[model samples]
Target: GESVGLHLPTLSVQEGDNSIINCAYSNSASDYFIWYKQESGKGPQFIIDIRSNMDKRQGQRVTVLLNKTVKHLSLQIAATQPGDSAVYFCAAEGNGGADGLTFGKGTHLIIQP
Candidate 1:
């Protein structure tokens, strides 16, 4: 079973298609969530973020959806290209005034040619 704040594993998609990734957070009080994409050797780059108050957010080619009830979150990629292939993860922060954000492990996104 998926626990709150638990990380999802990986997702594989073909080039030019859409890909969806999922996440879950433990903190009901968490008001902020961020999505990151990390490449082979580089650091994780910010993709997008959403506030708990909002059910969803959209970026250039990405969209993030949040479900507070289930403590679930998801990231959607439009026209997934090879460049979008990377390890993706989600981080969450609450009103606790914590120093660092709580994050999921990561999901390896593979772009099949």
Candidate 2:
């Protein structure tokens, strides 16, 4: 999984292929994590989620893997299509203070023909 911060902000992918969007979480102490996909002009849509206790989670053509050691996470999209083209990002719940999630930058997934 790629690190998320002021440094990494986006990712691009081709159509009809598998896309792996990497993400580095900020807090190892965070309990929950979520992935969202935001299409053009639309709100962020929930993709999948995982707990810090879990190593991996799978969904319909999607998978979320978590590594607590390096504090990394990745989203795997199978047979990514044009409809899958969007900004993908991850969110981690604050350690204790707030109940809100700290979101990573939007990774704009372009469907290259």
Candidate 3:
């Protein structure tokens, strides 16, 4: 019934530029939040995560901001580069993993020289 897909299929930027990845979730009752980065054929790597009780979380060279009021989520990347070019996805734990996560379509991030 619910599915997660990418918002922007592709994104391009310079080696020293910044990137912003966006994701939209269907389930509003989710509690846990996680941001993953998939590079090519590799598995998704955990970037950052936050709970419903908190609104923002930060990590090394990454920051995640959650807005439960609108059910919208966004990931901000500082100093984007070729290595940062990958598919970014946001997943939410529906009802504490009861219903699972409904991932977004997905967004392809591309880096330029």
- The lDDT values for all models are 0.85, 0.80, 0.79
Order by lDDT, highest first: 1, 2, 3
Candidate 1 Cα misplacement greater than 4 A, ranges: 1-8
TM-score of each: 0.90, 0.87, 0.88
For every model shown, the clashing-pair count is 3, 0, 9
Specify the poorest-scoring 10-residue window by lDDT in model 2.
1-10
Q: Higher lDDT: candidate 1 or 3?
A: 1
How does candidate 2 fare on TM-score?
Answer: 0.87
In Å, residue 96's CA in model 1 sits off its true spot by 5.1
Model 1 lDDT on a 0 to 1 scale: 0.85
Q: Which lDDT tens digits does candidate 1 get at residues 28-74?
A: 77888899999989998999999989999999999999999988999
24-60, model 3: which lDDT tens digit per residue?
6666777788888888889988889989898888888
Best by TM-score: 1
Please list the residue runs of candidate 2 whose C-alpha ends up more than 4 Å from where it truly belongs after superposition.
Answer: 1-8
